[model samples]
Target: MPLRASLRPGDTIGILGGGQLGRMLALAAAPLGLKTHIFCPDPQSPAFEVADAHTIADYEDQGALERFAETCDAVTYEFENVPAGTAAFLENRVVLRPGARALEISQDRLTEKQFLEAAGADVAPYRDIANEGDLFAALAAFGGQGVLKTRRFGYDGKGQVMIRAAEDTDTALERIGNAPAVLEALIPFDREMSVIVARDAAGTCGAFDVSENLHRNHILHTSTVPAGIGPALAETARAMAIRIAEAMDYVGVMGVELFVVPSPVGETVLVNEIAPRVHNSGHWTQDACLCDQFEQHIRAVAGWPLGTFERHSDAVMTNLIGDACDSWPDILRDPSARLHLYGKTESRPGRKMGHWNRITPHQAGNGSSGQKS
Candidate 1:
């Protein structure tokens, strides 16, 4: 159910994950007079430092979940992998924005693809693989080159393997732990982009500018706004995101990743995947837009009116993965560089330690021009 009344300044919000996303969400809530309570099993959760309160317990801890829910006006999650039982447990007691249905669809690759296709959205061709035979057949179907990704609990290039013709299928399957997986045809796309949109209980929606993304080792490296796609294609992507939000009756921020395929007539956008929360690509909004993605999510979950999604400048946001954050001093030297660190005690390879957004004056008449960085 939706919130009966907008959350007041002092109402505490419960967050289900304690990563950097949760940290950012807590920070966004503070200025609005709202407080956050982070629940995670990890003692070193970065979000715990910024949250007003925290519970270090497993997601399945019944006693802990009850106590945490009792203190908040609403609950939301920073990541998609929140155990299904955990989400259902809270939905009955508190307002859980975006709800369980969105989680159910997005937690599995096959389910997400089916949901998108049913909603009339185009997606990459895919097949489910349960065993080696299934993998071999699916590989042949895709002409022997595709990506095999685990059905659940995978992100940032983890839980996946690439299938190349003549490669050992057994070795590839073992890499994913022989888990239930989906084989997606390796789409030869011209570029990748994403649209971050927010929807409220009243059915109102708002969308930020399209962000062209570049990835390295399957992890997002940078996201730049004014993604050089022509205005028409950009609008098409935005419209698709809105359609998805409405289809899910979604009441929070959603990140819709798309693959831009070059067609004979023009560029076409295909739904790559759906993230049911604020996205890494949308981080650029922190400095460039009047209402950043984090704040937009807070407003939606709190049942407040969605804020304007206008960009005041052109910006590029780069992820400070692993030791990349070691250059904090150098980044600080540039006055125009707006830096944000996740407050992690230590960093490992491919871990998102932090991100920085660099903004520039919006060129005259090119208000929303297309550019790639």
Candidate 2:
């Protein structure tokens, strides 16, 4: 059932998966007089620090899930990997924004690609790999240069391997544990971009400015707004995002990563992947836009009016991964920089500790003012 009314102040919103995103969501909700309850298996979830309540139980814990759902007026997730069964169970008891259908489509790479293609979105050529024979055929079909990614639970380059040649196929498959995977033809693109879009229960939609992204070691390093793409291509990206959100009957913030491929006529965008929750690339909105992505997501899921998606400033967001956050003191010392640190005790390698956004007045032709430090 669709959400019939806006969630009033003081209503509790339950969040699945406790991480930096959930922590930020909890912070965003508090200012609107909304409370958050975080549910995750990790006892040291950073979101627990800001949330009004928390549950440290496994996702499959039925009793715990029911108890947690009873305390909230609505539910949303910070990550796409929330167990499908858990989401289904909660949908019956609480309002789960973006719905279980979105989760089901995004959890598997093959499913997500197929859904994008069916929706008239351009996607990289892909083949499903259920066995060694299938993998070999896919490698040959893609000219022996493709990425073999696990169909599920892969992120930040963890469950993927690049097959640069025929001889690398076995090694690539081994790296992924020979699990169910998808082989995607490597895209030769000009640049990578993402659009963060929101849709409310009322079917109203809004999209933030497209952001150009740079990734290092498979993790996002920085996101710059005003992507430098021509206005036409940017609008095209936004329209594609709206179409996707509408197709899924989505009711929250979604991040659609896209590859901008240069064609003879102009630039064409291809769907790379979809993130069902707040995305790393959208972090720049925290400082650049009147209504940040986090707040927009809260507003959407709560059945409230969507906030302004207009960006008043050009900004660049840099993620503090692992020990990169050790420079927090230096970042705080810089007056022009806005620092946001996730309260994680240890900064293990490749872990996203937090991020900072550097803002500058928006200029018509100058969007690259902020430099990553």
lDDT of 2 by residue, 99-217 (tens): 99999999999999999988888888999999889988887888889999999999988899888976787688788998899999999999999999899888888788889999999
> What's the true lDDT of residue 19 in model 1?
95
215-275 in candidate 1: lDDT tens per residue? 9989999998888787888888888888888889999999999999977888899999999
- Report the Cα RMSD per candidate: 2.7, 3.4
Model 1 clash number:
1
Q: Please identify model 2 stretches exceeding 4 Å from their true place.
A: 1-5, 365-373
Worst 10 residues of 1 by lDDT: 364-373
CA lDDT, every model vs. true structure: 0.89, 0.90
Query: Which residue window of length 10 is worst by lDDT in model 2?
Result: 364-373
lDDT of 1: 0.89
